[model samples]
Target: MEESAILNNSECTRKCSENLSAVEDAIYVIGGKWKLKIIIVLQESGNIRFNELQRNIQGISARVLSNELKDLELNGFVKRVVHAEQTPVIVEYISTDYSRTLKPVIMALSEWGKTHKRNIREDAF
Candidate 1:
């Protein structure tokens, strides 16, 4: 029984390690300085034009925003729509269903950040 328990423990550890690796990979795709920020903006604003997004994000360059949008679209987190019917074509960005799945994650992070900020302020005083 002892030997079997040891084997079970090792198997559990191996499964946890595999899960950890997958979580790391997911973070690698979405864990960036701007990715989550952009996602949050889209979540709040819904479909938004390129220029509008650039203006809203503050401090994000047009080039960087463009690159980040491309990455998000590639990762299935964002959808790009081109309105060619208009005299002047308009391109819009919207968060995809997959991206909506991150709402809880974003809210949790926001809550944690608020608490962290309060903690830092308290410590400083």
Candidate 2:
């Protein structure tokens, strides 16, 4: 029984290691300072024009925002829409349905951030 239990523990560790790789892959797809920020903005704004998005996210250059939007669209977390109805044409970014799955993750992060800030203040004193 002891030997069997040791084998089982080894197998469990191996499986966990494999699962961590998968989790890392998922993070790679969305892991960036700007990607999650852009996602959160799009989620709140629904369909937002390029210029508006740039204005909303302070300190982000037009070039960086464009690149991040393209990356998010490619990753299936965002969709880009071009409106021909506008005179010069209008482009908007919207969060995809799949990206809505991230709401809980974002919310959890927000809660943690709040707690972290409070902890920092307490520690400083």
Tens digit of per-residue lDDT, candidate 2, span 57-82 = 98899999999888888889999999
- Residues 69-92, candidate 1: write the lDDT tens digits: 999999999999999999799999
lDDT (CA) per prediction: 0.94, 0.91
TM-score between model 1 and native: 0.89
Query: What TM-score, to 2 decimals, does candidate 2 have?
Result: 0.89
Name the weakest run of 10 consecutive residues (lDDT summed) in model 2.
Answer: 26-35
For residue 17, model 2's alpha carbon misses the true position, in angstroms, by 1.2
Best-fitting candidate, scored by lDDT: 1
